[model samples]
Target: MTDNRTDPDPVADERTTLAGFLDYHRETLALKCEGLTDEQLRLRAVPPSGMSLLGLVRHLTEVERGWFGRRVGGRDLPPLYFSEPDNPDGDFDDLDSTDVATVFATWRAACAESRDIVAASSLDATAQRRDGTDASVRWIMLHMLEEYARHNGHADFLRERIDGATGE
Candidate 1:
């Protein structure tokens, strides 16, 4: 996106913006699901936990919407992964095979919107935390990076279980 796509140097300082953080997570997630089919991606790797690669993708999408859309975007969007009459983990619980395409598309869209919001503001810009605490865009970027890195760790193990593959 920075006209550096062809840069062979893998060590380039690519993360100069919060959008970079978002892109970093997206790439990490895609790696977690590399070469996986919808069935493999949705194959709830852990039964009792109901955590699958697809679920994580769906969950991350919801997280972005919740944090950036509802909280930072300051829109009255509905909550994800939580519903009174519905299952508590909506993102993980929904395993409808037919919805795979729709879910992935939605995830990508949410990420784009999140990037747009970050691109429109200064990383030092402040926003209220979902809990009404104060935070800067930089804080959100760092938090999401930490979160995705941790989840990607879990995803590594889960992905290996799906089909042995590993990396940062």
Candidate 2:
């Protein structure tokens, strides 16, 4: 596949560097899912594990909404795919009736919203999380980077298993 991802700028400032890397990881996830059919995207390639490319997209949508929208932006939004106590794994589990187009659209929207939130706020700005603890925008960005990096690793393996294709 053609990799359209731009490498993070080496001489950029702290904020720019973090955002660039986070975006790079985001693009990595998308690249992993590129050219796959709907059934392939939803295929649980790894045995005994319910993880799939579509599930990763759905889960990251919730994560972006939670960190950028709910926690950082101070929006009282509900979960996108899963509930708190019940069906927490719904993002990964409830894919039988999911519309692939809608899920991708929602994920892109969340990423855009997150970019807006980051652009409007300072890295030092803090917000209260669900546990009444405060997190700075810098911390949130780092956390998001970590989250995406971890999941993207999974995406790499999943994609390879699906089609024997692999890359950084």
Best by TM-score: 2
Model 1, 1-168: lDDT tens digits are: 012222224554433644555577677787787677888887776657788888888888888887777767787868655575767688877676547778778888888898888767777778887577889878887888887877777788788888777666
Q: On residues 1-168, what C-alpha lDDT tens digit does candidate 2 reach at each position?
A: 689999999999999999999999999998999999899999995679999999999999999999999888988879979887989899998898899989999999999999999999999999887788998999999999999999999999999999999999
Each prediction's whole-model lDDT (CA): 0.74, 0.93
Give the number of the best model, judged by lDDT.
2
Point out the worst 10-residue segment of candidate 1 by lDDT.
1-10
Candidate 2 residue-pair clash tally: 0
Question: TM-score for each prediction?
Answer: 0.82, 0.97
For all candidates, the clash counts are 0, 0
Error of 1 at 28 (Å): 1.2
